[model samples]
Target: MSHQLSDISHQTSDTRYQPSGVRNDAAPIGVFDSGYGGLTVLKELVKVLPQYDYLYLGDNGRAPYGNRSFETVYEYTLQCVQWFFEQGCSLVILACNTASAKALRSIQQNDLPRIAPDKRVLGVIRPTTEVIGEYSENGEIGILATKGTVNSGSYPIEIHKFFPEARVYQEACPMWVPIVENNEIDTPGADFFIKKNLHALFHKGPKVDAVLLACTHYPLLKDKIQEHLPIDVKLVSQGELVANSLADYLRRHPEMEQRCSKNGRQQFFTTDATEDFDNHGTLFFGAPVSSTHIVL
Candidate 1:
């Protein structure tokens, strides 16, 4: 399920745009996701870095990338990334976990150098993995994510790279995203799925003291998840972690920071019906969202 470099290089034609040439009209930082889940991350980014403008694109038309193959996810992600570049974005964040797991590396390694060497793209997994071990008392980390993310084994692999003694266990919650997207957080079905997945995760790794809600969409079900979680276990979400990481990143890379526009503006776009995106997006974003439609 892997694609060759030639397969995706054609999509990055506009990646060479220089920031200096467009400094007068600097573009907002791009935040992309498969659907509404990314709005959660965007919300935190706005809170921590309120001075900068941001553009968010959700590929709701071809979403639920959780079950898709690596090749398909990479292609869709690259296409969206290219769209961000065309919009004058010099930096893009793959806010979706499935995209981060399935496509981020290939896009960074193979496509960026040939197409947008000057541009930068980042993911949620690396930032979360870098600090995930510190939260665990015994280095027992449990991950609750989508099938694609779990199947990729990115968390365990990346965690091991940072914390060698850490024990990582994962449970794929395929039904959780659908439940959240459909606004079923309070329903019995939501509790059923949440308890089921948490049970599965703990059964395999009882020592898991900290559980990482690896999927952005999972935050909406936080209260319910905690209700069913063990009293002593810690629950970790990515929004704050990613926000802090981004702040540190900007501080470390002033060149990238200077390129980011700072009028405090925010725009939302979706590759699906705006009505649908706005309706569900508000719940994740914690505010009213007025979105426009865009064809990918």
Candidate 2:
């Protein structure tokens, strides 16, 4: 299911943009995902912070990090983080839910201090959880994610930490990512799997007031998901929510904000062949992007 690009070097970028108002903060913010899904997160980020530079790295070659062991995901994520740091990123966000659930803490705790002491690595789960409490009026939320994320129990744990009255229920949609990645988003094939997962989640819990699209890839299935969900249940996606959370994080930590370069430029990198990444990436990002081939 994979192929190689002979001219991967053509995908890399040049860093000679004119300084906006530089004092020494010209590094781009790093966004890493297991694959193209994180572009949804980055798209929202561009809307909120169109002034800052961003570099996105998708490990498409070893994607669906959801099915891999925690140790494997941790090692892969660590390699990507180090690559971003080497590319001059002061702050890196692990935009994949599985990576965040299984690898983020270990990276922050063990890798950051030893590798890039001044850099920071954040995750989508924390940002998504920070505001979900406000969306749960019935004190019940359902999470639709990959098996790895569900097994990690990050959503339930973090949600309780923020809203104890709110209950969390989750259903692992292992097939959803493959469906979306294969460009079957709006097909009947996708609809069948989407409805089946939503039904499982609802049947497993009390009438949930809101359903959290726990994986970034799940957002592509949002419309189909809503079509099958009860009228009373609201579907929450992580893109805008995560964007707002990141904006707030930067505001609260001016030190980090000041360190981010604000030139409104974006660069993309992938562990897969450039041609394949570009073809699929445009579908996720809503625009055609020429990506550099990179290895971690």
TM-scores for candidates 1 onward, in order:
0.92, 0.91
Candidate 1 lDDT over 64-146, as tens digits, reads 89999999999999999999999989999999999999999999999999999999999999999999999999999999999
Off by over 4 Å in 2: 1-22
- lDDT for each residue of candidate 2 in 249-278, tens digit (9 for 90 to 100): 876776777677765677889998989988
Instruction: Tell me which residue pairs clash in candidate 1.
Output: none
- Reference-based lDDT, residue 126, model 1: 96
User: Which stretches in model 1 have alpha-carbon errors above 4 Å?
Assistant: 1-22
lDDT of each: 0.88, 0.84
lDDT of 1: 0.88
* Separate clash counts for every candidate: 0, 1
Model 2's lDDT to the true fold?
0.84
